[model samples]
Target: MSKLKFFVFVLFMIISVSEIRSQIVINEIMYAPLDANNEWFEIYNNGITPVNLQNWKWKDATSTIRTITTQSIILSANSYLIICQDSNKLKIQFPGINGIISTNFMECPE
Candidate 1:
């Protein structure tokens, strides 16, 4: 009975850890941009399922934590999301770029 209980506990721990693992990844970052206030970072969803980004928090190496989005935003599987400090500046910098642009990150560390 004790051995069976230990086995069950181990199985439960494995399942719990897998479920808690995140599929979102930070793909790219423009930490030092030539244009002022043009800092941006790209996040990719590598999982098969879409993930909601509402209220998700992130912080740079030298910045405080900030919410990713106030509104409900879904990041589709195998898709990229760009979080920028200045949307207008990013658009002007990369005129032909595409994908979801979020202006939630107020500032990025240089």
Candidate 2:
């Protein structure tokens, strides 16, 4: 009887973890060497559905913000965005009905 209870508990934990994965899809990631001078990162969501960025995290050698809140952007499927400390250098890739995607780089401030 005890063995059967243990098997059921293990199965339940496995199923619970699997459900969480379907919600968030980390589509793409880019890392620029900051060398403690600057901190920046870009995370794209390629999920078929829109996900609220609230409570999501981006981490580096320095800090972590609880969320990415900029213009309340919503990334549609197959689209991408740039999240960085220096938005001035790289133009953010936003989705139009039809447009060419583009990006550039910023030299880290010394």
Candidate 3:
């Protein structure tokens, strides 16, 4: 009975953590783009509530992490925000994209 209770507690904790993490998701990634300095990734909000992105972070496979210090980055439900290397290059490459966010998270290799 004690073992079962422990298992249930662990399960509950896992579910709660997952729920907290379900608000945001990586929607798209454009790695190795033909244009110079055009690497980017898009984040989408999966939850029904708007998520304020102040101090929210993005990390690569390495230990490097970049935080969004911009206040009021409130992502509405089912919306996308892109984290990009170069806005000018991306704009020249893809003209009609409406939601392009530029950041200095990582520089594209020459």
lDDT-better candidate, 1 vs 3: 1
Question: Worst lDDT window (10 residues) for model 2?
Answer: 97-106
Which rank order by TM-score, best down to worst?
A: 1, 3, 2
Of the two candidates 2 and 3, the one with more favorable lDDT, higher being better, is 3
Reference-based TM-score of each model: 0.73, 0.44, 0.70
Please list the residue runs of candidate 3 whose C-alpha ends up more than 4 Å from where it truly belongs after superposition.
Answer: 1-18, 34-36, 106-110
Model 3 lDDT on a 0 to 1 scale? 0.77
Clashes of 2: 0
Q: Which candidate would rank higher by lDDT, 1 or 2?
A: 1
Winner on TM-score between 1 and 3 is 1
Q: What is candidate 2's lDDT per residue for 1-110, written digit by digit as tens?
A: 99999999999989866654454554445555544223345444555666555334543345433345523455565555555554433333332323122222222322
Query: What is the lDDT for 54 in model 2?
Result: 38
If both were scored by TM-score, which would come out higher, candidate 2 or candidate 3? 3
Judge candidate 2 against the unseen true structure and give its global Cα lDDT, from 0 to 1: 0.47
Residue 6 in model 3: lDDT:
100
Cα error, candidate 3, residue 77 (Å)? 0.3
lDDT of 3 by residue, 1-110 (tens): 99999999999999977876798998888877676477888889988887787767766656677765455677888888887878888788778787776767742222
